[model samples]
Target chain A: MNTPEPFLGATSHTPVRHHILSVLVENKAGVLARVAGLFARRGFNIYSLAVAPAETKARFSRITIVVDAESAPLEQIVEQLDKLVNVVAISDIAPKDALERELLLATIKTDVDNRTSLLDVVGNYGAAIVDVDAGSVTLMLAGTPAACDELERELESYTTLELHRTGRVALPRLGKAAVAADPD
Target chain B: MGGLFLYLTKRIIVQLTGAQALIKSLEMEGVEVIFGLPGGAILPVYDPLIDSSVRHVLVRHEQGAGHMAEGYALATGRPGVAMVTSGPGATNIVTPIGNAHMDSTPLVVITGQVSSAAIGTDAFQECDITGITMGITKHNFLVKSAHEIPRAVAAAFHIATTGRPGPVLVDVPKDIAQSMMEWWYPASIEELDLPGYHPVVDLDADRVAQAIELIRVAERPVLYVGGGTLKSHASAQLLAFAERTGMPVVTTLMARGAFPDSHAQHLGMPGMHGMYAAVTAIQKCDLLISLGARFDDRVTGKIPAFAPHAKVIHVDIDKAEFNKVRRADVAIRSNVAAVLEAWDANQASPQNLEVWWKEINAWRETYPLVYDEPAVEGLLRPQHVIESIAKAAAPGTIVTSGVGQHQMWASQFWKFEEPGTWINSGGAGTMGFGVPAAIGAKAGRPDRVVWCIDGDGCFQMTAQELVTARSEGIPIKVAILNNAYLGMVRQWQEMFYDERYSEVYLSPDLPDYVKWAESMGCVGLRATNIEEMHAAIATANTINDVPVVIDFRTDSSEKVFPMVAAGASNDDIMVHPLQREQS
Candidate 1:
């Protein structure tokens, strides 16, 4: 934390890394705001954050936060979160042993000339057209973060009227994913 | 779990308002005292508090109330509590909240809110208090309904006093406080199962064995203890560990009383203003067993050079502290006391550290903290005044300090004889902390002598609280090192910024401190020379019935010595500004 801030775009010497952390916290109101306030105050970059009840009882909530690790060290981020009383536990869900997904919605300008091309390009990325208009098409896609990024890039050539992503949600591969190691 | 189930099944819930429920919950938690101020939004909570046994000490300002609660927490190993109204009151206490957060003090702060309906309407005295306090608090809650009071109060106390203790807040809106609800004394609050709130209370055996092994083989080892030892009440354990192993222990400013400062193996505070030998010891140590010490920037002048040669075994309750500033060879996440109890190691004798001790003693002899008579006649030396107070302070004196040169001087000069004897806003470096905190400490420990070592700049910040002490008959003695400047900042400007003292000087006409103390209905005296200082101290010592204040006009130009310039490595420590060439 005492180290100087690195440049925005990480150089090869310090390549940007995506760190997915599964945080378990008390299912209480305003907890989300408290967690978000911490990140805002400390300037810890959050790529995406998703929260929901972890169990049927609704006593606890699981927050999957995808952090941009080029900003702060992973252990420091985890330690800061651990200081929050509502936060119960935080685990790094290694990408290799985790299931990660994000939802993307894009409202595109689809005129008579590019409507077919837009639909064909969306089909190539396994996305569904949720709404359609004579001059616009709203498409929704749920897939790996990379896949969603790829689909967004693919549709860039066409006029993208608007776009929104649900960030990333992830769960660790449980029951001893054979080649996993826990930190000491 | 079974008790909670039984409590739920058999308990008879009675209707009560939020305010009444809050009082009952606090009583259930064995809260014996409260320091607070009443305001429009918090008036409802005060109504029921009258009927309760909890003694409430009305303070002049919310900041005083907050620091008082912090002092109470430090004195008693229990959570200190504060109550204030919303908006201005909530904002006023932010300093103390930040102070507690930094020093790891346990406190539960309750603020009165505007009516539930008026919350977001920008009604009179309404502020987003919970939102404003989120960054400084461990956790906070805004009770929207009367029914949430019991659960919220339970959770507040639970979270505030547990783990790496910090301040937790519960904001009760005026309507919610007035509204009626079914209430039962929660018998199961201790068993309240909030998932993911687990605090590590035990050490891993392997890590313990590994630490013991490191301690055994190390030729030049140092025990770096911090506030956690005192926070966890592991001071005795630390003393035992140091004694059993015969290792020299250096306590940080926050950990002043954790180990007896007079102990044979004790090295004074290690930091920018620490003893030369202590700082050098860290730089040269081979195995650094850091017990509950976070390598704070102040403690570690230059990160990479801090204990560079040492292999560290960092133990703390907050695992986030691991490698936060300095890397550790072995990290143990457990309560310091519990780990100390579980850890076992081979016995060590001084014979083993014969050479290491020789080196340490040589450094101590070579770099002794020294101050010659001030070149100007009649100009009192700050260090001389502090040392005199240290000489006069009785056993079990609880010393509180406001940040600046005085704070470092008090830490350096005072010989803490026991744990829970030194209380200051260490991590937050708060000014105006001394006066109110001393009053709070005196209130908590009436039998012991409480002293406030304050700087002139710091004393002016919360000096109004002296009125509270006078009215309440909290007889705390204050020793003001009246150096007419923000001494620490002036020193920095002198050393680093070429002495263009920028706004660091306080007006010489800032009211005679003696008259100011007398105006607050306290005995006041002024000391100009060493003889006058001793005489004034003696006079103050006899008059314990009322608060005493002594204004010792110390030299404005005297700077704290053995300072490692900010952002400079520890090895580059300098005793004087002109000697930077050798440094």
Candidate 2:
């Protein structure tokens, strides 16, 4: 029997990095399920996903999906998503060529002794203390996904009572900056 | 709102309830027939259907209705329509929906839902059909209001018929079906506000040129045709392309009739249970020009080892299919007909395939499809029955089959010379597909004769549909190869599992097929030997007013030879023991 060789197609290789796919879809009932169900059925890994109404009219919802490229091919992901009837457009935003942001809200356990130090750490990351109670303080940060990750790491020193994060959202960078960064 | 105001001012507003609007929409789409059953949730829609131009054939089960719709679509190029009530009715049709999705058949399935207030409350006959069928359908619509009926129907038909055609579903709530609204139908698909749906129709020049360049330089080439060619109605173009290139063309199971079986350049079906020459030619070819054929696991065996020496040029209407399995050296995302038309215009001299044809011819001559006589003195072979039926049927007879050993025998023995003449559950391989599909095909093409080659196990699954045929005045012929066991499973158990047989046996005489046919108002006959089989077939051909069923008692021990075991390389294909011994 002849041993089979590994296929060397575009779908065969596993990417080492994450892919952020911004999809615009019709604002209809079960549209989100259709998009998410496609991913689950096709076995595509979703790291994070956030959806919100795009523009003022709310005719369409923009879905920001961060996919683990190691599980599914990028080309296949786009092609499959494009097949959905509600999906209007899909843009794969590269890390450098796009502006990415995420929002983090954390309630940290703090006392008099560590309150100043926690405030200093929060200040260093440019995070704001939205509310301050006797035992805990609530902080909010809206920044780059990497920045949010760093701030979350710094807050790990203190006890985190509760933490919440809005998944990353992205758009292609405009003007000459995006043009210069084009790998093509 | 502005468009509604303009329509109201420009034309007289005709007030109609949602059910009436739905039926009127089907009429506007020129739907000639619908296969369905009425229930509590769908009764309102049925009331309107009585007065509409669309003829409704009441099916015994929702599964039969779905398969009949699929058969109608497969026989005719038009999208088949099927309607059913909520819950079990919707769930029963999921198998055929998945089958249509896999085979890329154009089907528009409508399922009734509980009233708007009853949805999500687990009311009687309530189920989230749209959610259940999301993965299987090309797209689906859930009409919340009466006003959305016309647009939803229009969109469902458009999505089902265009691009890589597959099943699309519309789930209408019972309350929505009863609510009154002004009737307004969209003039065209463009007016339906579907910006996301666009099927690629034009061929990319660069890819075509690259494929042509490969064809020019390749010493050995094969034209691998698939169901997409038939879907695109490109059989003529494919025939011309094959003749011009002088390449050996191998049609897959779904594509049996896309190219004439009698054509000299044709190499028969390919893959597991495929012809020895056709499978060997693909394995040894240097250039593989795949048209509308996906590299399904059944055809590829072990994917990495399949056509290892070939540089594949894959063409399909669906872009996602390009690199889904085998990578294409040149990928053309367009209709198969468009690509063939483009390639036909850029005419080049045919390549010299003398050495290739000589090798393939030798294989064909050495391992021609052969079966030995049954060990029992008077037992009939299933293959012989299929051959006899094929010989007796008229030139343009349509053949449908249930999945199993019988389906393979029918595909192997029948000589198909035109497109849309062969319909079967190719992708999903759903059993009990033959009877309902044959009925649907006969209903679609009343002028042509339709024959269903079914297995006993498969016949029992949806045999109730024969009643639908009799009551609806559609005449079809069914030849049940009654081996008394699930022959394919028995073969696998014998070959790989130490012949335990397990529960594969279904007693030959339990139901009495002749009595069952008579119960369903069909003429039933029985055959045990070749002479009896011939006589049965001859009697079946003569009955034009009523459907006929013939029970052929065949030897259960026979297996489909020229086999490639599951997950094995194509190089390890096993010929029949008799043929091997002769060679």
Candidate 3:
């Protein structure tokens, strides 16, 4: 397992790439505000965020924050967050980790006959056809935003359908020890 | 002998004017003790403190002194004074100063500057302290002359304590501190026309009524109270509004105890670190009334989904915050108290959203705030310790908490009778906040019992302040939830990651807490069981001259339940020890 870097830095070693921050919090009011306040106050450019209570308790919830900043500030983001009153802990799950970040995109297609072809394209990206009707077909995709975007690009070949996507949601491989801070 | 006396008189004259003026000004504003550490440049200021009646607590570190002053100011509802020397000494206090700015604690920080001639030169121990602290301070000054010291000190107190209370800095040059001048205390503060400061809490009542009307029509209504509620001292109004309307209240981290925790209408804190109950309630509610709060993103995760079903009514003194995130459906730009009073008198029906309340409450009961029944049965349960503290606390007593398991437990177990009774560094989540905040809270209401509930990890971070508490004679009762490690991080390592103790586990040879407290001239209580805790609390309650510490050896494995796993929806709640898989 790769040890996570300390969540504080002046610059990222790597080039620009979309980063996702998944946070677990007490399921309470103003918790979102508290979290968002952290990001905004610290000037963390959060592209998107999705929150819901975990399966554990009503007082606990999970939040996935999407960003595209240098890796340098990510550490500061995490370290500063450890001080949040409602945050239990923060972990920057690396992309290589056994994790699944999922999203569902529903779109209305005008081309009925070409729907099978669109379904086939989505299938390649691990999405499945969830609904079928006269004018539109809704496809459910579970993967990274890149995967969903690729499917959406493929679907565009057939009548560029109406589309809706749930923000990114992820789950790490459970029962694994969290990677400690890298001493290097 | 006559020649020696003449030289001594001249030396003392220069020192008496600058330092004496600052001391006189602070005392006039009712400041008794200033928390700080000394350096060469600040020695002259320290000189008058020796002869002056005002007491001074010489803190071990300058940063701790700043935090202590912040805590004292927060507790007493008066401006807290913190003194430090040049460069690192002044820089060390920056964090607490910034904290005061964010949380709006009234504080006056006096830092010793290099001699006036070395102001901008790369002199020894020199720094642009004022420029560095500009963003965090309400106002700042560099006392170039001895006469400016009195005016600057007076101005700092006024700015720090009025309106939106925050930290103000007065950098006194070394030469100025040694100069002589007539000490002048302003007869009244009414003459200062502060450019940005608004002394009165004037709010448009008509606009507030419009906000109430919007709430009356909202099907699923939610109330969000922010730090402004605490700043405005509008706890009564906030509580009354939530109770009368049967609306679930969500408090920002800075506004933790703005609403009573025990209120059935309380939905808990919302945002990223917020409870699931609050997020769900906010997401599903039709109308959200934000009082004394800015719609910070933490509360409105993915703004589109934040209170997706609701139209937001925002009430705040800062107009810039209006629609800054989730746009307000009805905006009342006013002081919290004034707006609430106006809303209370308005013509509107209390919109009944019983069905909505039922749905949210159902979600709450299924995922109640409970941990696995004490993994180790013999250990003193953290909950029991918290409950006993609550039981023993006098009515309207104030409780402050540090960031960790202890804070969560306090939120779950402590039954708050009124708003503003509970204080914590919610938004900033500053560790070691409890002791200082408790000191502040105790100073705020002298008659009330102030309980500083802390985790051992957090307590130890700023334990040096026990000296400040002792020296000041502020009788704050500290309940240390000693889990023997960074309990919260350890829990994460246990559940999400494999159990790798790493650096999270604390050492066995811990500092002698009892001896430490005693050394500071404060009482200490160590409770390995429930009985001992009760006895300790009772004994501590009887002592008024000093503070107390109660060490509770809690179960290390216990967890805060009802968790939302990372990156999950508000509906996907992990109810402790069990999963409430369905919404």
Per-model TM-score of chain B: 0.95, 0.98, 0.87
Q: What does candidate 1's lDDT look like per residue over B117-187, in tens digits?
A: 88789999889888888988887889878887888888888888777889998999998989899986556
Mark the regions of model 2 whose C-alpha exceeds 4 Å error after superposition: A1-15, A176-184, B1-10, B374-376
Error of 2 at B309 (Å): 1.1
Put down candidate 3 lDDT per residue, B1-583, tens digits, no spaces.
9999888776333334687777777777788778889997787888778877776877777777877777666656567888999998999888788877777788899999999988889788899887777656766777778876766777788777665577888999999988888655565664442322444445666666777677777778778888888888898987776666677787766677678777778877776556767877877878778887766654565555556677778887655456556667787666788777776666344557789878988867765555445433466778788887788777887888888878877876776656557777655567887887677566556788888889888888888777777776777888888878898888778877888877898742387677777787888778776677778878877877788887777878777665555545545545555454443
Alpha-carbon shift of residue A8 in model 1 (angstroms): 28
Task: Give lDDT per model, in order.
Answer: 0.84, 0.89, 0.72
State the lDDT at B306 in candidate 3: 58
DockQ, structure candidate 2 = 0.41
Rank the candidate models, highest lDDT first: 2, 1, 3
lDDT of 3: 0.72
What TM-score, to 2 decimals, does candidate 3 have?
0.69
- Alpha-carbon shift of residue B494 in model 1 (angstroms): 1.5
Model 2 lDDT per residue over B1-583, tens place = 9999887788778999999999999998889999999898988999988788799999999999999999999999899999999999999999999999999999999999999999999999899999999999999988989999999999999889988999999999999999999999988768898977877556679989998898888888999999999999999999898898889999999999999999999889998999998999999999998999999888999999999999999999888887889989999988799889888899743479899899999988999888886435577989888888998889999999999999998888899999999999998999999999999899899999999999999999999999999999999999999999999999999999999989999988989999999999999999988878889999999999989999999999889988999999998899988887665
Which one wins by DockQ: 1 or 3?
1
Candidate 2 lDDT over residue span A99-156, tens digit each: 7778889999998899999989777777889998889999998877777777777788
Candidate 1 on A1-184: residue-level lDDT in tens?
A: 2333111111212124877888878888788987888888878888889988887456788888888787888778877887777887778876667667778899999788898888787777778999988789999988777777778778889889999988778876555242211232
lDDT of 1 at B264: 80
